[model samples]
Target: MGSSARVTEPQPLPWRTTRVVLWGIGLWAVALVVTLAVPALHTGDRSWWPWCCVAGIVLGLLGYSYVRRGRGNASDA
Candidate 1:
């Protein structure tokens, strides 16, 4: 409520975000395979699990591309 409010610049991430996204996508893929290969995992209550993994992969790809294009705070340095 005062004019003394200070806005600090965002600090850049110290690690590679694209790599992190790829790792997450890889883990999701592994989970998807596990859910498919294990009969009990994809049954009634959990049938939507595989689709979640697929979504993760799709979103991760989008994020990876965005970071690769220098659109995010992730530094390629």
Candidate 2:
């Protein structure tokens, strides 16, 4: 009898995850630049700072999730 071996097939990842990651990075970068330039905006309210920070955090979290997913798949493969 021939030797029995298991063969595993590679699965393709969803494109939505990749798109989210790319968009997340883009948004994060934009937020960073805006935060840095906020002072130059000359707004005395100072409320934009908090909003910008929050946006950055949200984008970062999204990016992290995608990265973690990719890493998990890589490790599994």
Candidate 3:
């Protein structure tokens, strides 16, 4: 490595994996309930709420894994 090469150290993350997982689970559950509970949401040719719910759940899970991996790396250092 040259002198100009810079190394960046790990910084603290603001959120936790558990929080993210919980949010994902909650969002998914709520969306599932809404989709299943109300007949209107399930009806029609197109729907957005269900997709949004899926997005939330996926993103939350992704966030959780990302944070967990980051934390592991930080701890190793």
Q: For model 3, name the residue pairs that clash.
A: none
Candidate 2: residue 17 Cα off by (Å): 0.7
Question: Model 3, 64: alpha-carbon shift in Å?
Answer: 0.8
Residue 70's C-alpha lDDT in candidate 1? 85
- Per candidate, the number of residue pairs that clash is 0, 0, 0
Q: What is the RMSD of candidate 3?
A: 6.0
Please give the TM-score that candidate 1 achieves against the real structure.
0.73
Candidate 1 runs further than 4 Å off: 1-14, 74-77
lDDT of 3 by residue, 1-77 (tens): 45797779877778765775777779797987888688788668646767777788787777677776676345667
CA lDDT, candidate 1, residue 4: 93
Report lDDT per candidate: 0.84, 0.67, 0.73
Candidates arranged by TM-score, highest first:
1, 3, 2
Better of 2 and 3 by TM-score: 3
TM-score of 2: 0.38
Error of 3 at 4 (Å): 39
Clashing pairs in 2: none
> Sort by lDDT, best first: what order?
1, 3, 2
